[model samples]
Target: MHASSRRQTNCCRKPSTSGAKAPDLGNYAMSLTAALNTALMGLSTIQAQTGVTSGNIANAQNPNYTRKMVQLTTPAVGGDPMAAVVAAIVRAAAPNLLQDYYGATADYSRLSATTDQARQLAEALGIDDTGGGQTPLQSRLTSFEDAVKRLEATPEDTTLKALVVQRGQELAKEVNRLASQRTTLQSQTQDDIRTGLDTLGDATKAIAGLNAKIIGQKAAGMPTGDLEDLRDAEVAKIAGLVGVRTITAENGAMSIYTDAGVQLVGTTAQSFSYDSTTGTIRNTNGDNVTAGFSEGSLRASLDYLDGSAGALTSSDGNVGAMEKFFNQLNSMARNIADVVNAAYGSNLFNYTAGDAAATLAIDGAFTADPNTLDATRMGAVQQAMRNTTLTATQINPAGEPNGLSTANVNIFGLVSGVMAYHARQVSDNEAARDSAENLQANVEQKFRNLTGVNVDDELAQLTVLQNNYAALAQVMNAIREMFDEVISIGR
Candidate 1:
């Protein structure tokens, strides 16, 4: 009886702690949800980073390509630490050191191109034989002039006269040909400018479209990285077409501007127009357009064609210096003939005679008395033709023929100088651009290290996710088994 009473008392005491605590179901569910989101976000980020890197590598060989990068942000969650969201790629932080490299490169390229062409043009004339220089133009001009001089020396020599006439005609034809080539180059430059403008317009439209898509998608709680990359790619293309300065807004939009600080694209798409006849590019309202290229190629091209180095018009309202040079050559040729005819009593050189009546007809092209033909005058004409009033209209205002008045300077000389400079610039910048490209590759590798997808990583994550799913399945099985046991016991 004593033992029974002791057991009863112990049972009655029944450990002061009351009931069993329920499992923290909400905490477990939240942890699993957070982990799942993290894994998904990581996968997305890795894929996006890979895409960006691949795009950069793909365009590595392209002269017009700019490198792209990836942007990431923390997803909006309180408990998740590993979750990531890919944001739009911000404009790359291209080093100004590289820009300087590019700018120098452009200057040199323009110089080289101009100089080389000028040298060739000089050679074409064949008269610039300060030494035994190999210039066809200068030599030919000298040969023609020598023939004229020889005829002057022996006026009765019909063979010499015929020779002078033949050589003169040949020299004239050559000068005309060279002038035509220059004109063609100018026309091509204009076309290039027009094309650049049209391209900018297209790029702007694409960028604007992408911006719209990205903004809308972001609002819908979708990732905007792909759309941002598309927009960045377009912007990079535009940079090659025309150097541009880009600014990023708080709203995740990018704005592009010209070197002159004119806005090209903003919230709305802007339009550009090309005038085929004038070979000019402008905004729809006809404002002269400036390039927004961060690199030097497009800017160099523009400078070569219409920038300060090759300005078509001056502040004083003068026409193109190059055009003026050609025109003056034509004028001087006609004047020389007129003077020779007036003084010596002969139409020895066929000059049409005046600005209106005495047109400069060389190789079937009607030009003013002073035209590009003057490039050959000194080599083809006798000393008498050298007599002239060197006026502003006759020569460049700076007093040399077309302002390239140095002793070694001639029409061809200018072209040579500019071309040479341009070539050097191109060579150096290309090297730097290559280096920058390499840096971009390094950055990409770093990015790959940080965020790129590895098969190993993917497999590991997949395993973790699979195991979690298996655990959930096992828990469900256990719960079902327990419920069955409860039913059996009741039965």
Candidate 2:
């Protein structure tokens, strides 16, 4: 309600001639008293304006606090049209710019998460971004191949024969280590997803609580500027986590939902939880909306786990970078075992028919006695190891077709290609991330300019209000002195 008051007073009138009817006074006369009341109203309004300016100055450093100003509205006071009230407090909020900032933030978060996770994968593979001749897997293959060639050159040399066995075992161990990293990385992805869900749930719940408070305060005719600022910050956080669309209610409440129409919050917030056992996320509605995520950090994590969304694979189905690299290592190991065994027309390496790369091992008999490799078949083994035109089928032929299935491709060349592919992935993603970062910064700055506070402007407004306040105080004093002078003359 507006701050106003009504006063009634008895008016003295001259006796009517010959007992005629007395003239009626409708209300208080519009004299110095009215002028004094008007000045008082002006002082009250200015005081409210100063309060708003003070708040703006106090919260100038607050990123979420938008600048506020008092809105004066003229309300009719009994037949007087000049009465004004501090009707409302207006905020410097721009809906369109805020929405744009939220959108840019979501896109940038997804891209950044994808790139950061992939970089971890590159590190796990021992894939330095530098474009050296070969990667870890490729280097192992080359060293093993060189050992085989040395054995071929001096078949009677026992030490060279032992060296070949040692090289083969070392290469197999490398494949085992890289394959293990995939499991570790996948587990890490799951933990990250759970952490993200916690933040999303907390933000949604806080927004819902704020919505309730805002509605109550608005109904009570109170200002909800601070509560609204906090709520908007939470909403922006949710936008980056899940990329939501917000709907504002008539009573200053807000509802949140994904673009697919799944409500995350109404008067009460919806609950979201992650189940590591099933590797899925379920909302309060009991629906798994993992695949429905379009853009956000959650979407990036989902893609990494599924190995289908943001994973880096070169036509090896829809596997991620780690899985793809594991497949390549397995294929190379089987090829090494199969080629060497076939060259000798005997089982030189102990690789099972349907086992993984970790199963590739040198035959115990060869490791025990190097003289066995001094046979004529050693020539064929050297030629097979040096062959660059080996087909995928010639290499292993038992497993499913994969990235290493290109025809007439050398094993070392395949490893080198994967290394180069990862290097390009890191480079391309970093470039895209930089672009997104710049765009996000640009839109955010524009949004802040429209809604954020300027301390200098607020201070200037404060000075002006102070001057008006001083003038109103002087007017009140002058009116007091005039009333006293009138009383003295009457005495």
Candidate 3:
């Protein structure tokens, strides 16, 4: 036989010595092949781990990105267990922490929305006139009172009467300006509600689509880490717009609902509509659920626009604080006009009944001729300003009784009371917003620590994977060399 064939035959031959058995070349070959296959699989696993680590490092700065990990598992092959293999990739997230974050986000958004609206209204009414320590309304009303006092002191001064009429005109002008601004704010709030509803609807649809995709991927045994991250982000956004509850199914599908148990997303998304005119929210079934949202910016805006605090008692119910303030100003203007007309037997101020604040003006008789100002009624008007308790009923912009029975105050007392009330509301809202925001920041940091990628940890994992890759490659190269040597011997 040729030299190479002789060697091959001896390799397969049994030992000639008595009681000795031949070597199992077939089994040895099978073992070598198995070892090679195992080594290859280890190399592939290390490579996949390296890729996962690299992705983590790449997305370290992405706030929405969650850290990913590969699960290693072993399987038996040919009666022996193989090395660990990459079984699945999973996103690292603490469900409890994430849920807490969602709640905090909703709270922060609600307080922020309320605070912004309150601040805007306060500014419009000049309630926050820190520069002068007095709002325009307060200053104008004070000037009118001073003019009245002057006329009281000199009951026959024609110039003083003209001055009183002029002050009344100025005060009426100021009240009208404030009312106009409030109307503008209401319109703007309506627009914002419409826009927010649109955004919420879009978010819900996207979540539903993602739910379908995730369910399909899970069924197909595909990786769903990225999809889950995207879904979580969408969920947070929706929570900020409206209070929500979530449920996860075994199929990896997520269901979303409002605090009021209104389903927002499931296998299919539910559509939403907002009626800015009536300040109503409805679902695809057209059912009114205005009170469904208990937390979120949408709820805050609705509360401010509708003037309903949802109180139980009639004295504090339905009427929003902003609308109540408007009504109080209207009542004060009406009371001033009524007392002056009754005492003087002449109309001194012209105003509509319900909208005195907006329609209040000096009567044409008084404006055309200062001599028409009745000084005889000056004492009664002054008494009304100082001691008369005027009662103003609260009503919403829709002219519905808000259940806030009555707000009682003297003439200038109502003006000061409204101003003070606005300042207090603004202050309280700011404090609440700040507290919620701080809590949200702390919660977000904790959440990031739990689920966010750590650069140092990822780097260490990458180093380990690199070493594993090198070791596996070396084993593969050694296997190749051994196979080549065996082939040479056979030759």
Best by lDDT: 3
Ranking under lDDT, best-scoring first?
3, 2, 1
Candidate 1 positional error at 480, Å: 16
lDDT of 2: 0.73
Clashes of 3: 3
The most accurate candidate by TM-score is: 3
Please give, for residues 1-491, the per-residue lDDT of candidate 2 as tens digits: 12222222223445559867543222223355786888888888998999999999999888889999788987666777653669888788888888778888888888788788768767766787346545566777788778877777776778887787788778877776776676677788788788888888899889988998999999998888888899989988887877778889889999988656667888789888877666578888889976556677887777666533334333522235455555555666677777778888988877653322345667888778766765567778777776745665654343433334455766665566556556666777778888988998999889888888889999999999999899989988988887676656555
Superior by TM-score: candidate 2 or candidate 3: 3
Backbone clashes in model 3, listed as residue pairs: 4-491, 307-319, 307-320
Give the per-residue lDDT digits (tens) of candidate 1, residues 1-491. 99999999998885755577745555655555555556556666666666555555555554333445567888565563565667665334343433333333433433433343334333333434535453444455567667767766666665665576567566556545545555565666566656666777898999888777877777776656556657756765565555556776756677877555667788886787655445344675668654433333444344444424345344311224334345445544544445444444444456643322223233322132222222333333454444433334433433322332223333333334333333343455455456655655554455334433344544555466456546645655665565555456545
Which of the two, 2 or 3, has more lDDT?
3
Tens digits of per-residue lDDT for model 3 on 1-491? 59999999889997769777766656766777988999988988888889899999999999989999999999897678998899999999889888888889999998898888878878888776658577887788789888988998898999999999999999889877876666677788888888888888888888888888899999999889999999999999988988788999999999998877878887788877888667799988899877887778988877776654353223521126456656656655666676656655677777775532446888887898988777877887777667766655421222433223335666566666666766777888889899999999999999999899999999999999888889888998988887776666555
Q: Candidate 3, 424: how far from true, in Å?
A: 0.7
Clashes of each: 68, 0, 3
Q: How many backbone clashes does candidate 2 have?
A: 0
